[model samples]
Target: MTIPAPTHQDMLAISERLGLGITEEQSKIYAEVVAKSITTYGPVAEISAEDTPLRPAGGSREHTVPTAEDNRHNAWFVRSSITEKSTGPLAGRTVVVKDSIPVAGLPMIAGSNLFEGYVPDFDAEVVRRVLEAGGTVSGKAHCEYLCFSGASHTNVTGPIRNPWGDGYSTGGSSSGSAALVALGEADMSLGADQAGSIRMPSSFCGIVGLKPTTGLVPYTGIPSLDAEFDHVGPMTADVADNALLLSVLAGPDGIDPRQHGVEPSDYQGALDQGVKGLRIGVLKEGFEVPGTQRAVAERVRAAADVLARLGATVHEVSVPQHRLGLDIWSTIGWTGMTETALRHNGIGIYRDDHYPVSLMEWAHRHGSAIDQAPPSVKLFFVISEYVTKHIGYAGYGRGVNAARVLRGKYDEILKDVDLLLMPTTPMTALPLPDPSSGIEDELRTSHPMAFNTAPFDITHHPALTLPCGPGDNDMPVGLMLVGRHYKEATVYRAAKAYEDTGEGAFRP
Candidate 1:
């Protein structure tokens, strides 16, 4: 069965709505991809083609791999159990779930083989929410094995390469979820973030990610981090869609033990209220890096003007101990890692029953080695408390305490600020990082991960990342909005305000 190609009209419609400047020729190709997906051969075509066929300027149909340039893809769309149809707010839209969440009947391997036959007893809390919103589950999004590595190249899934290019990495553990959304295979996706998993991939893939305030969404049937930072959040292409989904997903999930007494807010209403008169804080640490991407900075600066026009005030602010966050997060972050790793029978395999390899062994051998350390990436804490810990991966009492102090500083800073704004990545996406360059690719690729998103995880605050503009190379860059503890509405209002102003792109 041949998948139908997106009609020329379909291309025009999608292109207009998404604002992606696609050529008529590219549109035809995209339609072809869609047409082919509904038939029985759809699954076979997805993995068997190795790549799609491409025609040159002269129309010679040469073989072309399905890369990010496709803007649409079905090949290699990793996933979990799917619903042929959608049910709520995101109805008709395709979505992918990260591996950590339970999807009945699929291999809910959590990126490791240890639990291959372990059918989830039930749908995850977020899974229930997505289906209720009229959204269809496309597949379980591929992820770093066990959601352990920041880079997406786990042995089980190979590397979830950036759709932009084959050799480059899509920053992860949430890597596959981000890739699917970026590739336009799905409307949006879900991922769990304990540290920078959600934020980094969002930033790296040139999309948007929202790590809701702790307990905003129920976490039943999903894995947990430190009991401090595990959050299941939305990762999407548009800021508006993210706001839309939050409305559906945010609510009391009696199942998440962490939500002991927390109640979620009305996120949709908050978006309409917008950011006028809000105080958007500039986290001082975000721009402190050398070689920070100027394009990203310019867009954020322009965003401030839009906010000002929308009636919000922009001010530069810094927490007292931004430097110490590295220490605290490392300690706290890794302690959670070791403990989480200990939960698995295959600290190294995607399916423990089907595959017997240990995960850490694989990661240690293949994960981004710690050779390319950026001046700002701190690993002293991640190593000591998490990675190598043998005590069931429990090792962060000290770092967790230090993180508390850092949180206190952020709390004081937020006392007067409605939301915080920062450059999502100090630099835009670079070429595939070379770890042999003497630093961990993880460190270099994610210098801003700790400073931008990690602190919120520590403070129990909600944060969102938006694509502001292209950096020097025209690769996407992002801006961040962080709210005070559980004040996601405020953050939503502020970002929506900036988006409403329409002054979002870089002028140059």
Candidate 2:
């Protein structure tokens, strides 16, 4: 097959399609200029045999390792378990990193055929922190394909079911991270949340997950959805473990732009402070939504009563804009994430890049991975491409502005309350839908799952989800507490307060 360059006629047609009025002569000139530019810059410089390969940025393992057992739970994509006997805060803990985050020499599928068999040459910042703190690197948890869906079935590995209920969904894209911890496959795990991935699964699986303030935890080596919205945090079976993990992971790595100029805090120091005098604001709109489950809502309200009994005041606070959080998240995420996915290779947002260039190039030879991705990922790309091309991405900017306005509303309310409380998801985990379900069905089931958690991702606030005991069919319910940006200590304090009740964070 011969590659064809764009003709002057093609250029003219494109200009017309874009509503640019240009003469034939101008089109001809611009087409030739573009051809010349491509010819001049398309080829990379040739390397000599003497040239050295890029050195691995961090410590190295002997070689990539594989899982000892590949089982039905499908919770883990790779298992290269490592236990170092050093003593530190996380000593004797075995933790897994979400497949989207790199762990040196471990095969990371990232729950997509797009990244199958890719292994990083270096560990992610969080992985290094866990190892240095004496925690064991158990494996890489399977995530949703491209980390785009809130359902577990979207991954290449099939569904990651809730440990609590055999066929129920483990609210995702951090499915395996929560599943493994909930099942005791690992003591704790690292999860990445772009739009509620961490907290949603934590909610479904009855664990504790924290989406730290945007810049509070460095996102250096995690595969990104959007740098601005990307967050990496800890998921554990209890609040104390979560806080201890957060203490280790929170700090500047001097490389991630998100962590630039940010100071670290002692998260563990304030966790036991309790919510004695803290005022908790229950966001009225969060529970009054159309399909909000009564059982889940009642559990969250009951959780507020528990907090109130612990000496915290619970007030019904209304932030109407909170309802638009899902819409805004969609408007901003669809276009931005589609752009990144279309890039095919890894997005170059972090230092010490570990792009699976060979695997991606090979996959490209067969077909575009975007075209083959699961429904949610495909829908995002197709719709975003059309919307951005024809209707323009004006909504993306408006969405950003709306996020600030929403943040202002929360901040204003925060002036009168210490933290905002709500359900982590609109309902408890739903039964796993059929694989052949329509996109509409998937969207219908998943659209509201992030309503309560996506807002904080947009506003850069610290939000935490802790189990509020069982609800609706005895499935777990999650109560979320949102704090001011970088105020995760307060979020943890309140969560720890609930955990102290000895009723939350159930283990299956």
Candidate 3:
């Protein structure tokens, strides 16, 4: 369906219903931002003023479903452009960007205090790609601090709340990006997924999140996380949008030394090709870990059934090392965190990298230590090893080799199945429990960590997180479809099939 752009009145109502926290003037300003960045610059101030659209009475679920309605995000280049005269299939579509990456003069915060007033010197590779393809950026998004706050809040910016209920979680690092797309405030959003940042938020917010194979796209001009753990991808309401954005954003830039020889493909057109007669594999082992809500499992299985019904031969398979993925994921993530902690500290790019001083001091004070304990502690030990050891270049080499095994497994898995299906996040959106509450802090609500996300990063394979359904609390659950190294088109085609079958909705 050709969805129309949202009017200012439509946006204020949506912002209220979806908990967007934007004032009507801000909505007007947002559109003005779009006009300021493009060919039409003077029209925003000239537009007639009107009262905010009255909130619809207890809006229906149709209001919740995305319809390409986006107006609140148009200000200050929140995302890429969408206009009548843009370009091909994805031309005239508005796209949103995480503020971390450079988009010409837009401030590239990288979710940190250090770059407090830093605007980008030039467009990041992804931004150039979008512009070249006729897409205009609407505005930049707010992100978690250093994009490290897994619960998706930023001390430097603001929270992107859950669409189901404003009081709940939106899942993050890429927090605002998810909310924008899930609430139909933008057609597509570009976000980074390190330790499931993109997928986690996408799952919670009821949208599609693609955690593309690591290195499939350039990671230059952004703060460095461990190169292996970091990946850039798209978040959208549907596979068509996901594919379109990927087509624009995936490729090598000269500045990205790791980008090497890899290249991505045309994703939007591939969705229409369908996944009939393809081999589909359901990840049987390690998909369900602690806190995997029952509702999540049911929707994933429902999506599997849809794939089978569509003539994709479905088989349940186990990746014995997927368990290793969880363990190594911590090593992968925490080590990157430590490295980021050090990298930012050394460079002194942020405003307050000074205080929170001696993370080593903090680690020593609040360090998790035990004489003898559970298998999970081994992960802590690995982190401790990273903290104590100067893992510099050689340690990195070993980590890369360890991660590549997951890639080898992906190669094997894809040989038999055209794509692998798994749940994106183990549960759905959660309550915003106080992070300071010791009892609440111990709860493990998010389970879609390395078990589902790490492998794709390690293997450099493309994976898409598609909203399958919601749990008991009405928080969204995402079903993930992982494709071969460069075969994102096939995966999107398969995902679109299942998405259309209504398997992506809540089960009774």
By TM-score, who's the top model here? 2
lDDT of 2 by residue, 1-508 (tens): 1235678998889988888987898998988777766663334322222222322334444433344454457787767657555799989889988988877677777778876656666567788788889998878788888789887878886788888887889989999999999888899999999899999999999999999989788776566687658899999999889989999999887667777677767788887898889999999998976668999999899899989999999989999888888888888888878766676454533444334343344435534655667766788887888888877879788878888888898999999999999999988888887767767666655545888888889888999999998886889999999998888888888988888888664544
What are the runs in model 1 whose C-alpha is more than 4 Å off? 1-81, 84-87, 112-121, 343-382, 385-395, 434-448, 505-508
Off by over 4 Å in 3: 1-90, 344-386, 389-398, 435-450, 505-508
**In what order do the candidates fall by TM-score, top score first?**
2, 3, 1
Cα displacement (angstroms), candidate 3, residue 431, comes to: 1.3
In the range 273-343, model 1's lDDT, one tens digit per residue, is 86666887877777765557667787677776677777788888977576566556766765555544543
lDDT of 2 at 169: 90
lDDT of 2 at 440: 68
Cα-based lDDT at residue 401, candidate 2: 86
Candidate lDDT scores, in order, read: 0.65, 0.80, 0.65
lDDT of 1 at 388: 52
TM-score of each: 0.72, 0.87, 0.72
lDDT of 2 at 18: 81
The alpha-carbon lDDT assigned to residue 175 of candidate 2 equals 95
